[model samples]
Target: MKIAFVGKGGSGKTTLAALFARHMVETGRPVLAIDADINQHLAAALGAPAEEATLPPLGEHLPAIKEYLRGDNPRIASAAEMVKTTPPGRGSRLLRVVEENPVYAACVRPVGGVRLAATGAFTEADLGVACYHSKVGAVELLLNHLVDGPGEYVVVDMTAGADSFASGLFTRFDRTVLVCEPTLRSVGVYRQYASYARDYGVALSVVGNKVEDAADVDFLREHVGADLLTWVSRSAYVRRAERGTVGPLAELEPANRAVLARLAEAVDTTAQDWDRFTRYAHEFHRRNAAAWANERAGTDLTRQIDPDFVLGPSALSAPVAG
Candidate 1:
Protein backbone atom coordinates (compact mmCIF):
# COMPACT_ATOMS: atom_id res chain seq x y z
CA MET A 1 0.00 0.00 0.00
CA LYS A 2 1.17 3.52 -0.83
CA ILE A 3 0.13 6.27 1.61
CA ALA A 4 0.93 9.97 1.32
CA PHE A 5 0.66 12.59 4.07
CA VAL A 6 -0.05 16.08 2.82
CA GLY A 7 -1.40 19.32 4.27
CA LYS A 8 -0.73 23.00 4.65
CA GLY A 9 2.82 23.88 5.61
CA GLY A 10 3.48 23.42 9.36
CA SER A 11 0.32 21.39 9.69
CA GLY A 12 2.34 18.41 11.04
CA LYS A 13 2.18 16.22 7.92
CA THR A 14 5.82 15.25 8.21
CA THR A 15 5.50 14.27 11.84
CA LEU A 16 2.43 12.18 11.09
CA ALA A 17 4.18 10.50 8.16
CA ALA A 18 7.19 9.66 10.32
CA LEU A 19 5.04 8.33 13.14
CA PHE A 20 2.98 6.17 10.81
CA ALA A 21 6.07 4.73 9.12
CA ARG A 22 7.58 3.92 12.49
CA HIS A 23 4.32 2.40 13.67
CA MET A 24 4.07 0.12 10.64
CA VAL A 25 7.69 -0.98 10.96
CA GLU A 26 7.30 -1.72 14.66
CA THR A 27 4.24 -3.79 13.91
CA GLY A 28 6.33 -6.12 11.68
CA ARG A 29 5.14 -4.80 8.31
CA PRO A 30 7.56 -3.98 5.50
CA VAL A 31 7.62 -0.21 5.12
CA LEU A 32 9.51 2.35 3.05
CA ALA A 33 9.23 6.08 3.65
CA ILE A 34 9.98 8.48 0.82
CA ASP A 35 10.37 12.14 1.67
CA ALA A 36 9.15 13.95 -1.44
CA ASP A 37 8.61 17.22 0.37
CA ILE A 38 10.87 20.12 -0.61
CA ASN A 39 11.97 20.59 3.02
CA GLN A 40 13.81 17.23 3.22
CA HIS A 41 13.22 16.90 6.97
CA LEU A 42 11.85 13.36 7.08
CA ALA A 43 15.25 11.80 7.86
CA ALA A 44 15.68 13.84 11.02
CA ALA A 45 12.05 13.20 11.93
CA LEU A 46 12.72 9.47 11.55
CA GLY A 47 15.64 9.80 14.03
CA ALA A 48 18.59 9.98 11.63
CA PRO A 49 21.51 12.15 12.73
CA ALA A 50 22.35 15.38 10.93
CA GLU A 51 25.04 13.70 8.82
CA GLU A 52 22.94 10.64 7.94
CA ALA A 53 19.96 12.79 7.06
CA THR A 54 21.77 14.05 3.96
CA LEU A 55 20.41 11.37 1.69
CA PRO A 56 21.50 10.93 -1.95
CA PRO A 57 18.69 12.86 -3.57
CA LEU A 58 16.93 11.06 -6.41
CA GLY A 59 16.74 14.23 -8.52
CA GLU A 60 20.49 14.32 -8.99
CA HIS A 61 20.38 11.10 -10.98
CA LEU A 62 17.19 11.37 -13.03
CA PRO A 63 18.98 10.35 -16.20
CA ALA A 64 20.31 7.18 -14.59
CA ILE A 65 16.93 6.35 -13.12
CA LYS A 66 15.27 6.78 -16.50
CA GLU A 67 17.88 4.53 -18.06
CA TYR A 68 17.27 1.75 -15.54
CA LEU A 69 13.53 1.92 -15.82
CA ARG A 70 13.38 2.10 -19.61
CA GLY A 71 15.09 -1.33 -19.81
CA ASP A 72 15.34 -2.13 -23.55
CA ASN A 73 11.75 -1.19 -24.30
CA PRO A 74 11.87 -0.44 -28.01
CA ARG A 75 9.43 2.46 -27.67
CA ILE A 76 11.76 4.51 -25.49
CA ALA A 77 14.91 5.14 -27.45
CA SER A 78 16.99 6.84 -24.76
CA ALA A 79 16.83 8.18 -21.25
CA ALA A 80 17.02 11.76 -22.56
CA GLU A 81 13.70 11.21 -24.30
CA MET A 82 11.98 9.90 -21.17
CA VAL A 83 9.96 12.48 -19.24
CA LYS A 84 8.90 12.06 -15.63
CA THR A 85 5.45 11.01 -16.80
CA THR A 86 6.73 8.12 -18.91
CA PRO A 87 4.76 4.96 -18.15
CA PRO A 88 6.45 1.56 -17.98
CA GLY A 89 5.73 -0.89 -20.78
CA ARG A 90 6.28 -4.62 -21.24
CA GLY A 91 10.07 -4.47 -21.30
CA SER A 92 10.55 -1.78 -18.66
CA ARG A 93 12.02 -2.75 -15.30
CA LEU A 94 9.39 -2.99 -12.57
CA LEU A 95 10.35 -2.45 -8.93
CA ARG A 96 9.30 -4.49 -5.94
CA VAL A 97 8.23 -2.96 -2.61
CA VAL A 98 11.63 -3.94 -1.20
CA GLU A 99 14.40 -4.48 -3.71
CA GLU A 100 18.15 -4.24 -4.37
CA ASN A 101 18.06 -2.21 -7.54
CA PRO A 102 20.56 0.59 -8.16
CA VAL A 103 17.89 3.26 -7.54
CA TYR A 104 17.29 1.99 -3.99
CA ALA A 105 20.90 0.99 -3.35
CA ALA A 106 22.11 4.55 -3.87
CA CYS A 107 19.14 6.59 -2.62
CA VAL A 108 17.55 4.53 0.17
CA ARG A 109 19.03 4.74 3.68
CA PRO A 110 18.02 3.17 6.96
CA VAL A 111 16.77 5.49 9.67
CA GLY A 112 15.95 3.63 12.85
CA GLY A 113 13.64 0.78 11.85
CA VAL A 114 12.26 2.52 8.73
CA ARG A 115 13.76 2.56 5.24
CA LEU A 116 14.07 6.11 3.92
CA ALA A 117 14.43 7.74 0.51
CA ALA A 118 14.48 11.49 -0.14
CA THR A 119 13.67 13.55 -3.23
CA GLY A 120 16.65 15.69 -2.26
CA ALA A 121 16.58 19.23 -0.93
CA PHE A 122 15.96 22.38 -2.92
CA THR A 123 19.45 23.86 -2.97
CA GLU A 124 20.88 27.36 -3.51
CA ALA A 125 21.71 26.45 -7.13
CA ASP A 126 18.05 25.73 -7.82
CA LEU A 127 16.97 29.15 -6.54
CA GLY A 128 16.60 30.58 -10.04
CA VAL A 129 17.48 27.82 -12.47
CA ALA A 130 14.87 25.13 -11.67
CA CYS A 131 11.49 24.43 -10.19
CA TYR A 132 11.00 22.00 -7.28
CA HIS A 133 8.72 19.99 -9.59
CA SER A 134 11.82 18.79 -11.45
CA LYS A 135 13.23 17.40 -8.23
CA VAL A 136 9.87 15.89 -7.27
CA GLY A 137 9.62 14.43 -10.76
CA ALA A 138 12.00 11.70 -9.63
CA VAL A 139 9.37 10.52 -7.19
CA GLU A 140 6.64 10.71 -9.80
CA LEU A 141 8.71 8.60 -12.15
CA LEU A 142 9.43 6.09 -9.41
CA LEU A 143 5.74 5.69 -8.69
CA ASN A 144 4.94 5.48 -12.39
CA HIS A 145 6.98 2.29 -12.72
CA LEU A 146 6.96 0.51 -9.38
CA VAL A 147 4.61 -2.35 -8.40
CA ASP A 148 3.70 -2.92 -4.74
CA GLY A 149 1.78 -5.77 -3.11
CA PRO A 150 -0.08 -6.79 0.04
CA GLY A 151 1.65 -6.56 3.46
CA GLU A 152 3.97 -3.92 1.99
CA TYR A 153 3.76 -0.19 2.60
CA VAL A 154 5.24 3.00 1.13
CA VAL A 155 4.69 6.19 3.13
CA VAL A 156 5.36 9.46 1.31
CA ASP A 157 5.47 12.89 2.92
CA MET A 158 4.38 15.09 0.03
CA THR A 159 4.80 18.79 -0.68
CA ALA A 160 2.19 20.91 1.04
CA GLY A 161 -0.81 22.55 -0.60
CA ALA A 162 -2.28 22.07 -4.09
CA ASP A 163 1.20 22.10 -5.61
CA SER A 164 0.96 18.32 -5.84
CA PHE A 165 -1.80 18.73 -8.41
CA ALA A 166 0.74 20.38 -10.70
CA SER A 167 1.87 16.88 -11.58
CA GLY A 168 0.15 13.47 -11.59
CA LEU A 169 1.97 12.62 -8.36
CA PHE A 170 -1.14 13.20 -6.25
CA THR A 171 -2.86 10.19 -7.78
CA ARG A 172 -0.07 7.71 -7.06
CA PHE A 173 -1.08 6.69 -3.57
CA ASP A 174 -3.53 4.04 -2.35
CA ARG A 175 -4.63 6.42 0.40
CA THR A 176 -3.80 10.01 1.27
CA VAL A 177 -3.77 11.17 4.91
CA LEU A 178 -4.47 14.88 4.83
CA VAL A 179 -3.12 16.21 8.19
CA CYS A 180 -5.33 19.15 8.89
CA GLU A 181 -5.25 21.34 11.97
CA PRO A 182 -8.49 22.82 13.26
CA THR A 183 -8.05 26.10 11.39
CA LEU A 184 -9.80 27.82 8.55
CA ARG A 185 -6.60 27.89 6.49
CA SER A 186 -6.03 24.18 7.14
CA VAL A 187 -9.55 23.29 6.09
CA GLY A 188 -9.17 25.58 3.07
CA VAL A 189 -6.28 23.43 1.89
CA TYR A 190 -8.45 20.36 2.44
CA ARG A 191 -11.18 21.87 0.27
CA GLN A 192 -8.77 22.60 -2.55
CA TYR A 193 -7.19 19.15 -2.32
CA ALA A 194 -10.56 17.45 -2.14
CA SER A 195 -11.89 19.29 -5.16
CA TYR A 196 -8.96 18.19 -7.29
CA ALA A 197 -8.80 14.71 -5.73
CA ARG A 198 -12.46 13.95 -6.21
CA ASP A 199 -12.00 14.24 -9.97
CA TYR A 200 -9.23 11.63 -9.91
CA GLY A 201 -10.97 9.20 -7.56
CA VAL A 202 -8.42 9.74 -4.75
CA ALA A 203 -9.09 7.88 -1.50
CA LEU A 204 -8.45 10.57 1.06
CA SER A 205 -8.83 10.52 4.85
CA VAL A 206 -8.58 13.69 6.87
CA VAL A 207 -6.53 13.31 10.07
CA GLY A 208 -7.04 16.24 12.39
CA ASN A 209 -3.84 17.21 14.17
CA LYS A 210 -3.21 19.13 17.40
CA VAL A 211 -6.75 18.93 18.63
CA GLU A 212 -7.02 20.44 22.14
CA ASP A 213 -10.63 20.03 23.27
CA ALA A 214 -13.93 18.75 22.01
CA ALA A 215 -14.34 22.05 20.22
CA ASP A 216 -11.36 21.35 17.97
CA VAL A 217 -12.69 17.94 17.01
CA ASP A 218 -16.11 19.44 16.43
CA PHE A 219 -14.58 22.10 14.21
CA LEU A 220 -12.89 19.45 12.11
CA ARG A 221 -16.07 17.42 11.89
CA GLU A 222 -18.08 20.46 10.91
CA HIS A 223 -15.69 21.18 8.07
CA VAL A 224 -14.45 17.84 6.75
CA GLY A 225 -17.57 15.82 7.67
CA ALA A 226 -17.52 12.06 7.02
CA ASP A 227 -14.05 12.21 5.48
CA LEU A 228 -12.69 12.80 9.00
CA LEU A 229 -11.04 9.45 9.69
CA THR A 230 -9.45 10.33 13.03
CA TRP A 231 -7.71 13.05 15.05
CA VAL A 232 -4.51 13.31 17.15
CA SER A 233 -4.50 15.26 20.36
CA ARG A 234 -1.66 17.51 21.48
CA SER A 235 1.26 15.46 22.81
CA ALA A 236 4.29 16.29 24.92
CA TYR A 237 6.05 13.29 23.42
CA VAL A 238 5.65 14.70 19.92
CA ARG A 239 6.84 18.08 21.11
CA ARG A 240 9.97 16.53 22.58
CA ALA A 241 10.66 14.62 19.38
CA GLU A 242 10.16 17.77 17.34
CA ARG A 243 12.76 19.47 19.53
CA GLY A 244 15.35 16.75 18.69
CA THR A 245 15.05 14.61 21.81
CA VAL A 246 13.74 11.58 19.92
CA GLY A 247 12.18 8.69 21.80
CA PRO A 248 11.09 5.16 20.95
CA LEU A 249 7.71 4.58 19.33
CA ALA A 250 6.62 2.87 22.53
CA GLU A 251 7.08 6.15 24.34
CA LEU A 252 4.32 7.90 22.41
CA GLU A 253 1.25 9.00 24.35
CA PRO A 254 -1.37 6.24 24.33
CA ALA A 255 -4.04 8.39 22.70
CA ASN A 256 -1.75 9.70 19.98
CA ARG A 257 -0.38 6.19 19.44
CA ALA A 258 -3.88 4.82 19.05
CA VAL A 259 -4.51 7.48 16.44
CA LEU A 260 -1.49 6.24 14.51
CA ALA A 261 -2.80 2.66 14.68
CA ARG A 262 -6.16 3.81 13.41
CA LEU A 263 -4.53 5.69 10.58
CA ALA A 264 -2.54 2.59 9.66
CA GLU A 265 -5.66 0.40 9.78
CA ALA A 266 -7.49 2.77 7.45
CA VAL A 267 -4.67 2.51 4.91
CA ASP A 268 -4.07 -1.24 5.38
CA THR A 269 -7.66 -2.14 4.66
CA THR A 270 -8.04 -0.14 1.43
CA ALA A 271 -8.00 -2.38 -1.64
CA GLN A 272 -5.30 -1.91 -4.26
CA ASP A 273 -6.59 -0.50 -7.58
CA TRP A 274 -3.94 -1.43 -10.07
CA ASP A 275 -6.29 -0.85 -12.99
CA ARG A 276 -6.94 2.72 -11.96
CA PHE A 277 -3.26 3.17 -11.22
CA THR A 278 -2.20 2.10 -14.68
CA ARG A 279 -4.93 4.16 -16.32
CA TYR A 280 -3.74 7.36 -14.63
CA ALA A 281 -0.17 6.66 -15.59
CA HIS A 282 -1.22 6.42 -19.23
CA GLU A 283 -3.61 9.34 -18.98
CA PHE A 284 -1.07 11.70 -17.46
CA HIS A 285 1.69 10.55 -19.79
CA ARG A 286 -0.54 11.29 -22.78
CA ARG A 287 -1.42 14.68 -21.36
CA ASN A 288 2.20 15.59 -20.70
CA ALA A 289 3.26 14.30 -24.05
CA ALA A 290 0.70 16.28 -25.96
CA ALA A 291 1.26 19.40 -23.92
CA TRP A 292 5.09 19.48 -23.96
CA ALA A 293 6.96 16.20 -23.61
CA ASN A 294 6.26 15.05 -27.15
CA GLU A 295 7.64 18.22 -28.66
CA ARG A 296 10.63 18.00 -26.34
CA ALA A 297 11.32 14.41 -27.32
CA GLY A 298 10.62 14.96 -31.05
CA THR A 299 8.32 11.89 -31.03
CA ASP A 300 4.90 11.13 -29.69
CA LEU A 301 5.41 9.96 -26.13
CA THR A 302 2.11 8.07 -26.27
CA ARG A 303 3.91 5.30 -28.12
CA GLN A 304 5.63 4.39 -24.87
CA ILE A 305 2.40 3.14 -23.32
CA ASP A 306 1.90 -0.59 -23.76
CA PRO A 307 -1.80 -0.92 -24.42
CA ASP A 308 -1.85 -4.53 -23.23
CA PHE A 309 0.07 -3.72 -20.04
CA VAL A 310 -1.33 -3.42 -16.53
CA LEU A 311 1.09 -2.73 -13.68
CA GLY A 312 0.73 -4.92 -10.60
CA PRO A 313 2.28 -7.95 -8.85
CA SER A 314 1.25 -10.20 -11.74
CA ALA A 315 2.87 -7.79 -14.21
CA LEU A 316 6.16 -8.44 -12.42
CA SER A 317 6.24 -12.03 -13.70
CA ALA A 318 4.57 -11.45 -17.06
CA PRO A 319 6.64 -12.04 -20.19
CA VAL A 320 8.37 -9.06 -21.75
CA ALA A 321 7.93 -8.23 -25.40
CA GLY A 322 11.61 -7.49 -25.93
Candidate 2:
Protein backbone atom coordinates (compact mmCIF):
# COMPACT_ATOMS: atom_id res chain seq x y z
CA MET A 1 0.00 0.00 0.00
CA LYS A 2 1.08 3.59 -0.36
CA ILE A 3 2.88 4.00 2.96
CA ALA A 4 4.24 7.17 4.55
CA PHE A 5 6.77 7.13 7.37
CA VAL A 6 5.94 10.36 9.16
CA GLY A 7 6.96 12.03 12.40
CA LYS A 8 9.31 14.76 13.67
CA GLY A 9 12.80 15.29 12.29
CA GLY A 10 15.30 12.65 13.45
CA SER A 11 12.38 10.48 14.47
CA GLY A 12 13.60 7.43 12.46
CA LYS A 13 11.15 7.67 9.52
CA THR A 14 13.84 7.09 6.88
CA THR A 15 15.56 4.11 8.46
CA LEU A 16 12.27 2.37 9.06
CA ALA A 17 11.41 2.93 5.42
CA ALA A 18 14.67 1.22 4.49
CA LEU A 19 14.09 -1.65 6.87
CA PHE A 20 10.56 -2.17 5.60
CA ALA A 21 11.70 -1.93 1.99
CA ARG A 22 14.47 -4.44 2.57
CA HIS A 23 12.06 -6.79 4.30
CA MET A 24 9.63 -6.76 1.38
CA VAL A 25 12.31 -7.07 -1.30
CA GLU A 26 13.76 -10.06 0.51
CA THR A 27 10.35 -11.65 0.84
CA GLY A 28 9.90 -11.77 -2.95
CA ARG A 29 8.41 -8.43 -3.89
CA PRO A 30 10.25 -6.19 -6.33
CA VAL A 31 10.00 -3.08 -4.21
CA LEU A 32 10.02 0.58 -5.21
CA ALA A 33 10.61 2.70 -2.14
CA ILE A 34 10.11 6.44 -2.73
CA ASP A 35 12.32 8.94 -0.97
CA ALA A 36 9.92 11.83 -1.31
CA ASP A 37 11.42 13.54 1.69
CA ILE A 38 13.61 15.54 -0.72
CA ASN A 39 16.05 15.47 2.19
CA GLN A 40 16.29 11.99 0.63
CA HIS A 41 17.54 9.29 3.01
CA LEU A 42 15.69 6.21 1.69
CA ALA A 43 18.34 5.74 -1.00
CA ALA A 44 21.12 6.02 1.57
CA ALA A 45 19.50 3.46 3.86
CA LEU A 46 19.06 1.13 0.89
CA GLY A 47 22.75 1.66 0.10
CA ALA A 48 21.72 2.44 -3.45
CA PRO A 49 24.78 2.20 -5.71
CA ALA A 50 24.43 5.80 -6.85
CA GLU A 51 26.59 8.19 -4.82
CA GLU A 52 24.77 11.17 -6.35
CA ALA A 53 21.03 11.61 -6.91
CA THR A 54 19.12 14.35 -8.71
CA LEU A 55 15.94 14.51 -6.68
CA PRO A 56 13.12 16.90 -7.55
CA PRO A 57 12.19 19.69 -5.15
CA LEU A 58 10.19 18.15 -2.27
CA GLY A 59 6.86 19.68 -3.38
CA GLU A 60 7.62 22.00 -6.23
CA HIS A 61 5.75 23.16 -9.33
CA LEU A 62 4.58 19.68 -10.18
CA PRO A 63 1.38 18.41 -11.79
CA ALA A 64 -1.47 16.89 -9.79
CA ILE A 65 -0.59 13.47 -8.33
CA LYS A 66 -3.11 11.77 -10.64
CA GLU A 67 -1.64 13.65 -13.58
CA TYR A 68 1.61 11.72 -13.05
CA LEU A 69 0.08 8.28 -12.96
CA ARG A 70 -1.14 5.93 -15.73
CA GLY A 71 -4.60 4.57 -14.94
CA ASP A 72 -8.34 5.18 -14.69
CA ASN A 73 -8.94 7.99 -12.18
CA PRO A 74 -11.46 10.78 -12.40
CA ARG A 75 -10.74 14.43 -11.67
CA ILE A 76 -13.99 15.82 -10.47
CA ALA A 77 -13.84 19.22 -8.78
CA SER A 78 -16.70 18.60 -6.39
CA ALA A 79 -16.07 16.13 -3.57
CA ALA A 80 -19.68 15.05 -3.55
CA GLU A 81 -19.58 14.42 -7.27
CA MET A 82 -16.21 12.63 -7.27
CA VAL A 83 -17.37 10.45 -4.42
CA LYS A 84 -20.39 9.63 -6.49
CA THR A 85 -18.27 8.73 -9.54
CA THR A 86 -15.28 6.72 -8.13
CA PRO A 87 -13.55 4.10 -10.28
CA PRO A 88 -15.90 1.50 -11.72
CA GLY A 89 -14.97 -1.60 -9.71
CA ARG A 90 -14.08 -1.34 -6.09
CA GLY A 91 -15.74 -3.34 -3.32
CA SER A 92 -16.20 -0.36 -1.01
CA ARG A 93 -17.07 2.00 -3.84
CA LEU A 94 -15.13 4.71 -2.04
CA LEU A 95 -14.99 6.90 -5.16
CA ARG A 96 -17.96 7.36 -7.39
CA VAL A 97 -16.02 9.16 -10.13
CA VAL A 98 -12.75 7.84 -11.51
CA GLU A 99 -9.82 10.21 -12.06
CA GLU A 100 -10.37 9.86 -15.89
CA ASN A 101 -6.53 9.88 -15.92
CA PRO A 102 -5.56 9.74 -12.22
CA VAL A 103 -2.29 9.67 -10.32
CA TYR A 104 1.28 10.03 -11.56
CA ALA A 105 3.37 7.16 -12.75
CA ALA A 106 6.65 6.41 -10.92
CA CYS A 107 9.51 8.67 -11.99
CA VAL A 108 13.09 7.50 -12.19
CA ARG A 109 16.12 9.38 -10.94
CA PRO A 110 19.17 9.88 -13.20
CA VAL A 111 21.39 8.25 -10.60
CA GLY A 112 19.36 5.82 -8.52
CA GLY A 113 18.48 2.44 -10.14
CA VAL A 114 15.01 2.64 -8.62
CA ARG A 115 12.32 4.58 -10.43
CA LEU A 116 11.02 7.23 -8.01
CA ALA A 117 9.83 10.83 -8.15
CA ALA A 118 7.64 12.99 -5.89
CA THR A 119 5.14 15.80 -6.65
CA GLY A 120 6.72 19.24 -6.99
CA ALA A 121 4.26 20.48 -4.37
CA PHE A 122 0.76 21.45 -5.29
CA THR A 123 0.58 25.13 -6.05
CA GLU A 124 -2.51 27.05 -4.85
CA ALA A 125 -4.55 24.72 -7.04
CA ASP A 126 -2.15 25.59 -9.79
CA LEU A 127 -3.10 22.20 -11.31
CA GLY A 128 -6.69 23.24 -10.65
CA VAL A 129 -7.38 20.22 -8.40
CA ALA A 130 -10.61 20.87 -6.56
CA CYS A 131 -12.42 19.08 -3.70
CA TYR A 132 -13.10 15.77 -5.53
CA HIS A 133 -9.49 15.72 -6.67
CA SER A 134 -7.19 15.21 -3.68
CA LYS A 135 -3.47 14.83 -3.09
CA VAL A 136 -4.73 11.83 -1.13
CA GLY A 137 -5.82 10.29 -4.46
CA ALA A 138 -2.16 10.52 -5.36
CA VAL A 139 -1.63 8.48 -2.22
CA GLU A 140 -4.18 5.93 -3.37
CA LEU A 141 -2.18 5.54 -6.55
CA LEU A 142 1.05 5.17 -4.58
CA LEU A 143 -0.52 2.59 -2.32
CA ASN A 144 -2.00 0.77 -5.30
CA HIS A 145 1.40 0.76 -6.97
CA LEU A 146 2.90 -0.79 -3.90
CA VAL A 147 0.49 -3.60 -3.03
CA ASP A 148 -1.39 -3.77 -6.28
CA GLY A 149 1.31 -2.70 -8.75
CA PRO A 150 4.18 -4.50 -10.43
CA GLY A 151 6.24 -3.64 -7.37
CA GLU A 152 5.65 -5.84 -4.35
CA TYR A 153 5.65 -2.91 -1.97
CA VAL A 154 6.24 0.83 -1.94
CA VAL A 155 7.55 2.81 1.01
CA VAL A 156 7.21 6.61 1.08
CA ASP A 157 9.63 8.04 3.61
CA MET A 158 7.95 11.35 4.32
CA THR A 159 9.34 14.77 5.23
CA ALA A 160 9.34 15.82 8.88
CA GLY A 161 6.15 16.35 10.87
CA ALA A 162 2.53 15.68 9.92
CA ASP A 163 1.92 18.71 7.77
CA SER A 164 0.46 18.66 4.25
CA PHE A 165 3.08 16.58 2.44
CA ALA A 166 2.72 13.74 4.92
CA SER A 167 -0.93 14.42 5.64
CA GLY A 168 -1.81 14.63 1.98
CA LEU A 169 -0.21 11.26 1.31
CA PHE A 170 -1.39 9.65 4.55
CA THR A 171 -4.93 8.89 3.36
CA ARG A 172 -3.77 6.70 0.47
CA PHE A 173 -1.54 4.62 2.73
CA ASP A 174 -2.43 1.45 4.57
CA ARG A 175 -0.57 2.70 7.58
CA THR A 176 0.93 5.90 8.92
CA VAL A 177 3.82 4.26 10.81
CA LEU A 178 5.04 6.47 13.64
CA VAL A 179 8.80 6.02 13.50
CA CYS A 180 10.45 7.42 16.60
CA GLU A 181 12.53 6.68 19.68
CA PRO A 182 11.65 6.94 23.38
CA THR A 183 12.12 10.62 23.98
CA LEU A 184 9.15 12.72 25.03
CA ARG A 185 10.25 15.21 22.44
CA SER A 186 9.88 12.54 19.76
CA VAL A 187 6.76 11.16 21.40
CA GLY A 188 5.35 14.66 21.49
CA VAL A 189 5.83 14.92 17.73
CA TYR A 190 4.17 11.56 17.26
CA ARG A 191 1.25 12.76 19.34
CA GLN A 192 0.80 15.83 17.19
CA TYR A 193 1.15 13.88 13.96
CA ALA A 194 -1.24 11.22 15.20
CA SER A 195 -3.75 13.95 15.84
CA TYR A 196 -3.16 15.05 12.28
CA ALA A 197 -3.79 11.50 11.09
CA ARG A 198 -7.00 11.45 13.07
CA ASP A 199 -8.02 14.67 11.42
CA TYR A 200 -6.96 13.65 7.92
CA GLY A 201 -8.37 10.10 7.94
CA VAL A 202 -5.00 8.32 7.84
CA ALA A 203 -4.30 5.07 9.72
CA LEU A 204 -1.39 4.98 12.20
CA SER A 205 1.08 2.30 13.32
CA VAL A 206 3.90 2.94 15.83
CA VAL A 207 7.40 1.58 15.21
CA GLY A 208 10.04 2.66 17.72
CA ASN A 209 13.61 2.84 16.52
CA LYS A 210 16.61 3.12 18.86
CA VAL A 211 14.34 2.41 21.74
CA GLU A 212 15.22 0.88 25.14
CA ASP A 213 12.06 -0.09 26.95
CA ALA A 214 8.51 -1.42 26.97
CA ALA A 215 7.65 1.84 28.64
CA ASP A 216 8.49 3.49 25.33
CA VAL A 217 5.77 1.50 23.55
CA ASP A 218 3.41 2.23 26.40
CA PHE A 219 4.09 5.91 26.11
CA LEU A 220 3.46 5.90 22.35
CA ARG A 221 0.21 4.01 22.77
CA GLU A 222 -0.93 6.37 25.49
CA HIS A 223 -0.25 9.40 23.33
CA VAL A 224 -0.91 8.11 19.85
CA GLY A 225 -2.99 4.97 19.28
CA ALA A 226 -3.09 1.42 20.61
CA ASP A 227 -1.38 -0.49 17.80
CA LEU A 228 2.40 -0.31 18.15
CA LEU A 229 3.56 -1.90 14.87
CA THR A 230 7.10 -2.80 16.00
CA TRP A 231 10.14 -1.52 17.77
CA VAL A 232 13.39 -1.47 15.75
CA SER A 233 15.70 -1.23 18.71
CA ARG A 234 19.04 0.59 18.69
CA SER A 235 22.34 -1.06 17.90
CA ALA A 236 25.97 0.02 18.33
CA TYR A 237 26.82 -1.08 14.81
CA VAL A 238 24.81 1.95 13.68
CA ARG A 239 28.09 3.83 13.91
CA ARG A 240 29.17 1.79 10.92
CA ALA A 241 27.38 4.45 8.90
CA GLU A 242 30.64 6.40 9.09
CA ARG A 243 32.06 3.59 6.98
CA GLY A 244 28.86 3.20 4.95
CA THR A 245 27.56 0.03 6.56
CA VAL A 246 23.97 -0.59 7.73
CA GLY A 247 23.58 -2.18 11.13
CA PRO A 248 20.03 -1.43 12.22
CA LEU A 249 18.78 -3.94 9.68
CA ALA A 250 20.87 -6.76 11.13
CA GLU A 251 18.96 -10.03 10.92
CA LEU A 252 20.48 -10.83 14.30
CA GLU A 253 18.14 -8.34 15.83
CA PRO A 254 15.22 -10.77 16.09
CA ALA A 255 13.21 -8.18 17.91
CA ASN A 256 13.34 -5.71 15.07
CA ARG A 257 13.24 -8.44 12.43
CA ALA A 258 10.14 -9.98 13.93
CA VAL A 259 8.57 -6.58 14.17
CA LEU A 260 9.32 -5.95 10.51
CA ALA A 261 7.82 -9.28 9.52
CA ARG A 262 4.69 -8.55 11.49
CA LEU A 263 4.46 -5.09 9.98
CA ALA A 264 4.73 -6.58 6.52
CA GLU A 265 1.92 -8.95 7.30
CA ALA A 266 -0.19 -6.20 8.77
CA VAL A 267 0.34 -3.87 5.84
CA ASP A 268 -0.18 -6.74 3.43
CA THR A 269 -3.41 -7.82 5.02
CA THR A 270 -6.69 -6.76 3.37
CA ALA A 271 -8.21 -4.72 6.13
CA GLN A 272 -9.66 -1.49 4.74
CA ASP A 273 -10.75 0.02 7.99
CA TRP A 274 -8.08 2.28 9.52
CA ASP A 275 -8.91 1.14 13.03
CA ARG A 276 -9.31 -2.53 12.07
CA PHE A 277 -6.00 -2.65 10.18
CA THR A 278 -4.04 -1.18 13.07
CA ARG A 279 -6.17 -3.12 15.53
CA TYR A 280 -5.12 -6.50 14.15
CA ALA A 281 -1.59 -5.26 13.74
CA HIS A 282 -1.52 -4.21 17.37
CA GLU A 283 -1.81 -7.84 18.46
CA PHE A 284 1.91 -8.00 17.86
CA HIS A 285 2.34 -4.71 19.62
CA ARG A 286 5.27 -5.04 21.96
CA ARG A 287 5.11 -8.80 21.45
CA ASN A 288 8.60 -8.97 22.84
CA ALA A 289 8.04 -6.47 25.58
CA ALA A 290 11.13 -7.27 27.61
CA ALA A 291 13.46 -6.79 24.66
CA TRP A 292 12.93 -3.11 25.18
CA ALA A 293 13.84 -3.31 28.89
CA ASN A 294 16.97 -5.37 28.31
CA GLU A 295 18.70 -3.64 25.45
CA ARG A 296 20.86 -0.51 25.45
CA ALA A 297 19.62 2.12 23.02
CA GLY A 298 21.84 2.15 19.95
CA THR A 299 23.00 5.31 18.18
CA ASP A 300 23.80 5.04 14.49
CA LEU A 301 20.88 6.32 12.40
CA THR A 302 21.84 5.87 8.74
CA ARG A 303 19.28 8.28 7.29
CA GLN A 304 20.54 11.85 6.93
CA ILE A 305 18.04 14.69 7.44
CA ASP A 306 18.70 18.40 6.88
CA PRO A 307 16.00 20.64 8.32
CA ASP A 308 16.66 23.31 5.71
CA PHE A 309 16.23 20.72 2.96
CA VAL A 310 13.40 21.34 0.51
CA LEU A 311 11.02 18.84 2.15
CA GLY A 312 11.77 20.06 5.63
CA PRO A 313 9.88 22.67 7.61
CA SER A 314 9.74 24.97 4.61
CA ALA A 315 7.59 22.63 2.49
CA LEU A 316 5.66 21.55 5.56
CA SER A 317 4.73 25.12 6.46
CA ALA A 318 4.00 26.19 2.90
CA PRO A 319 0.24 26.51 2.57
CA VAL A 320 -1.82 24.62 0.00
CA ALA A 321 -5.56 24.63 -0.71
CA GLY A 322 -7.55 22.12 1.35
1-322 per-residue lDDT for model 2 (tens digits): 5567877788777767777777776676655556656355666666554444344532331243322321222222222222111221111112111122222222434222343544334456555553322333443333322223323455777777755432224455656787877778888877787666675556678777777777776766675556566676775544454246764355336766787788887787734453333332222112212233113223211111112222111222333232
lDDT of each: 0.91, 0.49
TM-score of model number 1: 0.98
Query: Mind giving the per-residue lDDT tens digits that candidate 1 earns over 46-77?
Result: 98888788999999888889889999788888
Q: How much is the lDDT of residue 298 in candidate 1?
A: 90
TM-score for each candidate, following the candidate numbering: 0.98, 0.58
